[model samples]
Target: MSEQTAPRTAAGDSTDRPVDRTGGGTGRGSGGTGRGSGGGDVGGPGTVGPEPSTARGEQTRQLILETALRLFRERGYAQTTMRAIAREAGVAVGNAYYYFESKEHLIQGFYRRTHADHVVAAAPALAAETDFAARLRAVLHAGIDVLTPSHAFAATFFKTAAEPTSPLSPFSAQSSEARTEAIRLFEEVLAGSTAKVDPQLRPDLPELLWLGYLGVILYWVHDRSPDQSKTRLLIDGAVPLVDRLVGLSRLRVLRPVTTQVLELIRSLRH
Candidate 1:
């Protein structure tokens, strides 16, 4: 819930990889203030004829998205141009624009797709585990597994995205839908778990877990250890601490501490 909880030095648009989206610029994966560049009609208004078939349109859209991402990864989000994306994808510039409003939108698309894939990856593990900690671990580990493929690009876009105020930041409103979807998955993890947590914490656990996840990600972004081995240790070690902390919530001796913590959490929203 709070990007502030993570080290500011590690930031990027995580398309399953580390990246800086300071701008989510031309090649176009985006954060918040980064709006897909709005433009005029794809072709000069009256110059259109038959549209590409539905299937063809989809393929073209995929090509443009792939090309844009490649360019973003290759040239840095700020340096990649929409025109270059068009040329690389072998589509008209107007056609590319038609599929995507701007570079930022493409970035959002990348995130949305990545999140969708993440959901798929975590499903099996979550379904098989009913224990809160186990499910939580599965979900968290699944995130890293899905991201492993993109490790090489992780740091590239993180620099741009780490900006607190940047729309390209995952915390930005532009990413609300994707962000919420991720939170919801954690919610499911809690729902299926047998962990007897404080009633209020149960509802809020997903968001808290997500915050913890962001912290892990922050570490992961900077983790250069072989196979990012350090991050795996972090997850394995941290989950038990989290599990124990949740277990502590039901103890009467900790009631005052829990109440104060809950109060602090509540105060933040106001």
Candidate 2:
């Protein structure tokens, strides 16, 4: 599947919000870069000692992460530098470095936590439902729920990623294998589904659905509705309907259109 074909819920990363992909320097949330200043170690080397200091270290790290998150949102990703983050965080540049290697490294925290949250939110609905259609709907809704909170950041990030040269682009060489692994995990979710797609297409379907999912996310990113109202509508209506359509792909009449769409997507990827 292409990026646009990925099986994504209405809630997604940067793709979910609306922002300018082109480098206008003024987008949604944040998209800036800078360097760190004030050198000091806030969370020094971890010693296998008492729990109190560990808790303190944890709190400090959280503070930095939270502070950085805010700054990144307020400023652009490119403008938010390590130095700026450290200054705002009330810590030394070395202290921020102790926790994260660079601003990009800090961004990874957003992706990592987002995926973890996706599973947590989806689990409950998935567990309660037995029908494949219902389960799929729950999974999609869960993803959307996790994503809504970061809509602003999500839009900016996706916009940045659309650029082929951006380091943060999903397909960029700079994207760590670990991040790709996250996409792989989402693929696993699709594997667990009971959607009656072609057996031959199963392996590729997850990737394709992921791409499709991303396409909707691209739309969601630019959505400006109150509470991203349009995204909610997509979740409530389009998703389940697509799920049903996929379930019905085995029908002879629809097969031609499906094949054409899939082929079109494949062409774009190449």
Candidate 3:
């Protein structure tokens, strides 16, 4: 359902916390800021230096990423190269590789950046809505908003990411970090909601919601309608059905079926 339809509670009225839209976080490839000179040895092949520590270094890293995305949009993903990105970003080719090893890695950076933006964008809605359906709808809408700028690029890039063997695939090991973070966002949506999810199903629900989100993205990639309004309609329509199913999970009659579905999910994980 639309944001206008979602119910609110006193708890949902909490003030919003500040979010770091700067794409800073700890962990390899999490875009954590590092400490060091912005310039140094580029390092030999097969070896890379540390992440950007200084503000200047981080700025440089962001510059390269921004340039790469622009070029990816101007040109096609396949047509863009590291050298071109470095040149456009006004950094050495090695510096581009320093921040991101390959074009695939650049897309990974895009994933992290977009997710971070989605979190920031959804903070207001999350802070203001306690209904599970509303929170889910807000987060999903926030995701589409964050992704709208890259829609053209995503359409082209989907070909590569669709390949099972491609590192760009969302399900690939290379994408585990971003994927995990996305699932966790949904977990936050569930955790803060008033929905009484079945205890057995609670743990796996976030990933399932994430998969549904992927379905939405896939539809969005092909959505040629004005402003992708169709995709928004899809979300508005589907969330209530999801809410009903989640609500149904608490019924004793559905427990056995939920158990089976959980078993199926666990089996597929291995």
Candidate 4:
């Protein structure tokens, strides 16, 4: 099978770090920024006015994230310490802590940024078409478009994500808000369509769909398909199933089950 390949390039933007299969902290000048858009197709912060920072707090935050992502990618996640990231970023450890409550919090930024980029990438495709299935497919494909580029090192990244101590766990305490926000975006995609379903029930559907999507991402991450071909097949096959499931959500019999499932999800959070 032909391997799946994603666009690979330096993540240039606010953060500064290097891109490599092995993770390690690079010396100051050698550190390149993570793919400003690389990472995951999670979601983004809702529309809000820019903060009233007279100075550049956002800029500093970006720098720290970029720096950390580079090192995390170059130096395996565990090997890249907060102190090392601080030193390499030319910021004091305290300063880094001020922006990120913990090292885990810093890693959450990568997921958040990647999710935001996914929204950006999918927008054009979604906007160009009105079919619900097409939009859904575009959204799923957007995830692949963003993730495949980094497949070479993606497995290592996922390995770090699996360790409970590591900060990258999508289910980690640090990632809840970001994860919820990403889930909401997927919900928005569902809501945007003309799919007939109870208005109240539809709101929570995104979280379920996101859970399904994350499963695909997990598969893709560990996928060794020459170029991650298995990952691509998964994307193509799973997304439509999700769409069909979404359509079935309108059935009366599924309503009670859906409610119970959502409650179960909420319970998991607590």
Candidate 5:
């Protein structure tokens, strides 16, 4: 069986840290002017137009994230400490704590930020296509695109994620929000698709699709092929089989199998 692959490039904007997409300018610069430590709120004592404090906070948060990612890439996740990241970001250790409660929180922040970028990247593809298989392929490719830029550091961090007891593990409740968001994106993929799935399979398909993505990611992490081309091949190959299986879900002959599969899935959820 040939392996699946995805679009290999950076997952989000090429920048190490993505900006606040809500249009609030989270400037990329590390030098946040603590100047105007005065203005705040919708209309507080010192300000008129939106205060610089929000921008400062955004910049500081991004700065810390950028610094921490750099350290993770350069020093490895296990070796990088929040204190080290704070020093590198030029923020007080306490300030880093204010922004992120722990190293795990920083990683959670990383997941949130990266997933947001993935949502952005996948949108155009989803909007442009309606075929379930095509939409799914595009979304999966978009996901890999978001992660590709950080390919260098992913495996190193996977060590932490692999620890079942670690909060960073994708299955951990701590990562539930990120996991849910990713699954919901897959639901969008299903909702927009023209293909018909067995209603029995419909509700759980998004999660199954996300699980497929996780499998792709796991493969990509270990993939050493030239440019991870094998991973791409895997995606290309898997899509057809997935499409076929989905198409078959509504067939009368497959009802029994689908019932058993759904039951097994439900069991695992508990």
Candidate 6:
């Protein structure tokens, strides 16, 4: 399948042209500033304003985000700056900061957008497949497809994210929004599958699968294989084992083990 590209500006260009401020600056209620008067609150000091509510504002926001991601890919995350992103995006530095407070926020936006893309890409497979393992495989492959474009960037970004206390860590509180949404996607995967899971394991299975996916992503980051083919093989090999284990969870013999696992997970959370 062809790689899915990031959303582009409405004009379908990446030129460094200034944002059009012809009508009240980007959108209605924007007060000639990038921030709309009644936009969604970002809830932090020094933030320009709430998120843009108008279509034009949203387009501008997307343009900034796409530009940031591109620069991050080319310049490496540490070398890229908000000024550079704003200059490349053709928006004012304040405007760029208006959309994303910092580089960390931009990465969070990357996390959110990539997950959203994964969901859209996985929808077809989720709708067409009922078998547990097949559905799982489809979702996993879809994730790789969505991420394929960013593989080069991801390789370097992994170093910062790998730090246990870094906000970039997928398990960090700062990344909770993206993490929660990703786990929710796994829940959908399990919900639509035909597999009969243990009643007690149902609630926790999605999180377990999401954690497994993080492992897959880690492997993919280090995968030097052409086109990350080895990661694909890993997924293909791992899914059946996961499926079998999930299926066995319904057996009475595994109930105690499943409960112990759940208890351990809960303990770690606190």
Model 6 residue 165 distance off true place after TM-score fit, in angstroms: 2.3
Point out the higher-scoring one by TM-score: 1 or 2: 1
For model 6, the run of ten residues with the poorest summed lDDT: 1-10
- Supply candidate 2's per-residue lDDT for 262: 76
**For candidate 5, what is the lDDT?**
0.75
Which portions of model 3 show Cα errors greater than 4 Å? 1-51
| Candidate 4 per-residue C-alpha lDDT over 91-196 given as tens digits, one digit per residue, 9 for 90 to 100 | 6443454456445666577678888889899888766776666777788878878877666656765776787765577877767888887787677677677677
Lowest lDDT 10-residue stretch of candidate 4: 40-49
lDDT, model 2: 0.59
Q: Which scores better on lDDT, 1 or 6?
A: 6
- Choose 1 or 3, whichever is better by lDDT: 3
Clashes by residue pair, model 6: none
* Model 1 local distance difference test score: 0.70
- Estimate every model's Cα lDDT from 0 to 1: 0.70, 0.59, 0.79, 0.63, 0.75, 0.79
Provide the lowest-lDDT 10-residue window in model 3: 1-10
Angstrom error at residue 262, model 4: 5.4
Ten residues in sequence with the least summed lDDT for candidate 1 = 1-10
User: Per-residue lDDT of 1-270 in model 5, one digit per residue for the tens?
Assistant: 111221222211112222223333222132443222343222211111222258866777788888989998998876776557866876655455546656677789889999999999999989999998899888888888888878899998787788878788999999999999999999999999898899999998999999999999999999889878888889989998999999999999999999999999999989
For TM-score, the strongest prediction is 3
lDDT of 3 by residue, 1-270 (tens): 011111222222111111223344212454543322343434222223355776766787788899989988998887776667866877545456667756788889999999999999999999999999999999999999999989888887888889888787899999999999999999999999999999999999999999999999999999999999999999999999999999999999999999999999999999
lDDT of 2 by residue, 134-164 (tens): 6655766676778887787776667667777
Clash totals for all candidate models: 27, 43, 3, 20, 13, 0
- Superposing all C-alpha atoms, what RMSD in Å does each candidate have to the true structure? 9.8, 12.1, 14.2, 13.3, 12.0, 9.6
Better of 1 and 5 by TM-score: 5
